[model samples]
Target: MSPPDTDLLHSLSAELSERLKDLLDQALLGMIRPNSASQFAQHAPELENFREAITHSDAKDDMDFLRNFREFVPTTNYEPYRPYIAKFFATPCKESDVKNMFAPGLPYCLAVSSMTSGKSAKTFPTYRPAPHLLHHPLYLSFPHSEGSTLSPSSLGLWQVLTVECEDGQSSKVLPVCAVTVGFQRMQMNWEVEHDKDRIDLWVPGKTDPFAISLVKSYRAFFILNALFALSDRRVATIRFLFASVFVNFLQYVEEEWPLLVDCIEKGIIPDMENVDHVRESLEKHFTANPLRAAELREIGPPGIQGWAVRVWPDLKMFIGITGGSSAASVPKVTHVLGPSVTMQAPCYGSSECFIGLPYYNGDPNTDFKVLPVDGVIEFLDVHSDEPFERVLSAWELVGGGHYEPVLTTRSGLWRYRIGDVVTVKGFAPDDGLPVINYLHRRNGGLEMAFGVTACTESQLTNAIVSASKRSIGQIIDFTIVGDERDTPITYGYLVEIGGEVGEDAKMAIEQTFEDLMANNEFRVAFWQGRARKPTIRLVKKGTFTEYRRQKCDKTNISMGQVKVPIILSDSTSKEWFLQRVIMEL
Candidate 1:
């Protein structure tokens, strides 16, 4: 029997794409208009006060408010550190010992030790005694994947806290120490009970008005339909909630350092009710600052970067994954946070093995120094014909080389390929450990005509980067999809332009891509043989946002975990992107 024609498959795909697009549009419209004004009336009082505070407060008033507000929020204490220290050091120290150890001040100890040793805690030769020992442990945790046995719950409430405590005496603690609360719950089922548990972990039990308000805002999301409304008020409320929670927590930590320690030591979990009382108190405070209403109106769209700046203006460092989709989002995030906040990637690891830590230098793209204590690290040259034979030790890695990480962990993962591909950034100065940066996933690329020619995620990213530089406006986020059903397989590029880019600029971008592919040997060869000329589709604003939201909804992945991959390898993701192409340029 003869096989079905390729044209038939392509036609069917086109029909399916159109149908999906229509459904998605209707769903998005429904999501935006979820609640009526009457439904939001209960939150009006709180919202009004929030608006007043933002509009009327002067620079001095704002600073004072932040100062006073931070006094009430609960922060991380020695309790969470006790378990972390015990796990990392394999020690059986008591809670009192942990407190005393950090008594002379945690930040001072870490600073002095790191400066003297010329190495981070992750690379310290051995655990030193007393004050010096504070700089020798990099608190690592697996928050993403479910394959690992370690649960965030095992460490208790503070395990889920994102706040970092600083001792007033020395003014030294890790500039950035945070628990992964948001993404940690990405693996959980999205039921009400699970959602409640996640919220409790995120905000913790705190009776302070701000804390209670923050917790209530999170609770509001439990009524998903009500919170998902597209109204400006809803968006503003969501932003305000995050801003209030974070800013309040920051101020609370800064002001009530001793009280925080007391709570931790006494194991006192606050009663997290009194939303009405909290609202009343906040309203009273804001009523004095009438100008804050205008300021509130001026607050930009809902995003973390802006909220972060307002809450913690003294932010010195930000630690997170800077590779893959995270890398793409860096431009948008940093732009929001401004230039002061230094970005740092803490380590390169997955559910399988806690790999290593990056250097503390100011460079955002600094490579991770492999942790020898964690497990055995190996690299296989993925481009090599015999990848197995090309296995190299951690010390044997060459600078600027690409290799897949193979970890042999103490947790029974023997020579397991974690599927992450990394580039050797360089070797550490003090230690010979190769400083590597994660590049992409091993199976994360597009293969045209059964590997006749394959376009890597890195390559596609490079093209987008090159195009953005040549284009009039910045390209915020982008995704590439391989359409195999077509007779000549084509790659569709869905590019989201950040600002206004006229038709002329868009054409210029297309021309730039054409010129780039023409100059490139591999892409040129691929197009000539199997694939057709790649098409660039400029999607409407919020296309990627909707894409991410929909994906999170379908997969139960949290917004934190919903990153736009440069290359969509999965059929579902590719189809979804293809359907959302608002315009072909």
Candidate 2:
């Protein structure tokens, strides 16, 4: 039956089962060597220190390193994921011994992000990679079938935590900020006021060290006002929730991560040991006592994931806007449209620059595909323009041959760095259109299978929201994020109801949304029997705005920002939720 194109799980499994055979076939073909004269050509793009790597993977044999992933890439790796790198129980990216921490083969050390910790977020990768980092090309695409499984050692968002006790010594947690959304871009100059008091969305660029630091740190914080585009490419539904546009990294690790949103909303924090002691601890805390309010935060994002598009309705508005963050375990419905769903894993990127990978499908755990040949990638010195590692003139091999990615794209970059590591296998005849695919940085984030796993928060949002018949202004604000590790589900929260929703109304709305998301039988079963519909919480007037105002400590204006859900991994998060969602109300 067309190889079960609609069923992501089955497609991935079936394809991976044959991965062994696929690889063998490719290896045999690789036995043939390419002509030497045609092998070492150069199209040096006025760069440096990366001439050799550019052609390192050139088809040594006729196919060992083919121009296509589908041809050479076995559905499965011959060997199990055996990382010979370092293993950090508590310290994922950081360790007492950085050298002994990261393993090879797969990956033991995850690439970290600078997530929003109460204090400093980044601590690991103590060593700074010189700017332009180069990785594979397939790191950008999110095909249709992936989402089978994840490795036990898979690292979520990288985080580094530290507390200054006015002492000489120190302790730390390497918490990373999700590559997509966080306090960074959300920091706006627009502030609303309540009479004499000013509500702060983006702290005034005038004072506040935090605000000043954020403003000074990243010169450009691009805010995209993305709406869901339905089947007909119509804006079916509309809401506003976009903290980041890079939901790529958060897409890995699970399939139906959306279900977590229902569980959290229903106050179901069942013990999940996805990460050994860490997940076990989270389970205990989440299921412990009063499930009332939960303290749920992210190591980073998936923690505070981002958007599918760019554009804000009234970006530079008159007042304070609500905050947007996927900081909740329940995940947030940043914005949902009729059949508008997207997933993106933001890892596979370099701190020095932003190179990334998208999901294989709208769900997490999907195999990833590289970006289009129209894109280019390049590695650079962390602080300078010197080319460091490799270079990808991938545009050259588009449909011509597959190779590692290294270039500078039009996506605001110079000696642009692509964040991923890969060895080209072969090309994929994607619907008669071929594209290159490759592996990514291991030990740092989620693992992968065959058949193209993928995710794009923006795309997902677009699918749902686009399908919605609601007007653009109906959904004031919202955010959507991956919730767990076991399944590829999603969770969302709509701050404004647009109208009242009683039992029947809620059911109708929920069912409508389910129809949009769970179109197939597998998804329908999960929602009807297992997957609970998204929880629609109607915040009392300015409850969220008030909460933000109190936290801001600077103003009391209302800015309608769609934040990611509260991620409750421990008692701390649960308790915080209790105080916020249960107690205050």
Residue-level lDDT tens digits of model 1 in 241-360: 111122222233333334333333333322233244333333332212223323333443334445434533344444456556544454555555556655556566653345777654
Give the alpha carbon lDDT tens digit for every residue of 1-585 in model 2. Answer: 011222222122334435533543343232211111111112113222223333565644444333332222211110111121123333333333332221111111133333222222222222221123222232211112221111001112233344222233643333333322221211221111121132121121111111111211010111101100100012212222222211211222122244333344353432332222222222332322122112221221132233322211111111011221322211233331101343333323333223334333322212233432223242211222444322333222223232333432222122322333343322333311112233332212211221122322333344334323332223323333223323434343333322333334334345435544543533554545533334333343333333332322221111122122332223333233333331100
What's the lDDT for residue 207 in model 1? Answer: 14
Name the candidate that leads on lDDT: 1
TM-score quality measure for candidate 2: 0.30
Cα-based lDDT for every prediction: 0.41, 0.26
Error of 1 at 146 (Å): 32
TM-score of each: 0.52, 0.30
Against the true structure, whose TM-score is highest?
Answer: 1
